[model samples]
Target: MENWEAGWDDGEVGESSFDYSNHTKSQFLDDVERRLKLFMVRCVKVCRTLPGSYDGQHFGQQLIRSSSSAAANFRAVRRGRSQKEYFAKLSVTIEELDESLFWLETLVSTDLMPEHRLADLIDEGYQLLKILSKSRKTASD
Candidate 1:
């Protein structure tokens, strides 16, 4: 099992375990960045388990591309040149994550992979999406 998958089993990434109440902005962002990176790695690992068929290859490639892009853009957000740059990068990161979620859903909807196998990753994707969206909204305000 991947680290993120293990995370779910261990209750490390569960909703109750995701507390950031006592964290400073920098600490929260840093933690998010680490999670994003791990998410990318987990996606790649999942893709590797996909069948080598046409649909599998297609969705897997798209999944890897979007998840990796999301991670990279989020990293850029951390080093953003200004507020405008930060918002722009964050927007791209959100967009990429949305795409990643789509690909993941497609994989399961088309019966490429079992839904149960991907439930944790899909949950994590949505969780990350929510976290980033709230962060962007908070920053904008």
Candidate 2:
């Protein structure tokens, strides 16, 4: 079995306690990595749908850069050897996620993409912003 699944035999995921705080370190890391991957995929798909014009190309590249950084910087967060370092790297994810939301809003405003196309992604970015913000607050507290 994969590393994240290896601890299932220990009742790591019983129904009584199914929250993220209950997970092992590896499981948590894997969860973050999985989320980043999925977010990046969403970015790629949305960027590809942009119209073939100057604004489309500009926002597409901006979206790709921010979304990709959010995921890639997560790896850096995982590598952090100290609380300060971790928070520093994690902050990058927070900023990039927010930047992504801005770009998505821009696309919708310009009528370059339909609102339905970005609704889920917009919501996800908002959710992630809340999550990451809470995490950083907790870390420093």
Candidate 3:
């Protein structure tokens, strides 16, 4: 049996017993999801403050959809019934994460957003993408 199954049989299923450190996989995904939801709310607040410019409107729409989609797709992945479906949903989650990153970059680069404020969100997006990509590969295998 694998390490996880072995641990399960030994009744070592608690958080302290699970060795998530030194591994990219994390229980932190729950925290990330929570933060992402808050970040999306902030994005919506920022978007609401923008003037009626074409670029601003367009980017605001993209940012809102993509940011929310990341969380939505992740929740879907969690509910997936099979490994294949899980991987597929994770792939979608990755796409949404990427799109969200792109919108953030565009906002910063185009001077629509302050770089300092965008930095944290951008870093979080990158970290989430890395985690989700690893998850997808592992699930697919």
Q: Which candidate is the best by TM-score?
A: 1
How would you encode candidate 3's per-residue C-alpha lDDT over 1-141 as one tens digit per residue? 211111121223322232344333234455545655776777677678665799999999998999888888877766778767877887887898899899889998998888997776677666656555655655655
Instruction: Report model 2's TM-score to 2 decimal places.
Output: 0.82
Lowest lDDT block of 10, candidate 1: 1-10
Candidate ranking under lDDT, highest first, comes to 1, 2, 3
The local lDDT score (0 to 100) that residue 118 gets in candidate 3 is 75
Candidate 3 — which pairs collide? none
Runs with alpha carbons beyond 4 Å of true place in candidate 1: 1-17
Q: After superposition, how far is residue 100 of candidate 2 from its true place, in Å?
A: 0.8
Model 2 has an lDDT value of 0.75
Each model's lDDT comes to 0.82, 0.75, 0.67
Model 1 local distance difference test score: 0.82
User: RMSD, model 2, all Cα superposed?
Assistant: 6.7
Which runs in model 2 stand beyond 4 Å of their true positions?
A: 1-21
Tens digit of per-residue lDDT, candidate 1, span 4-66: 121122233456347765566677778888989998999999999999999899999999999
| Winning candidate number (lDDT) | 1
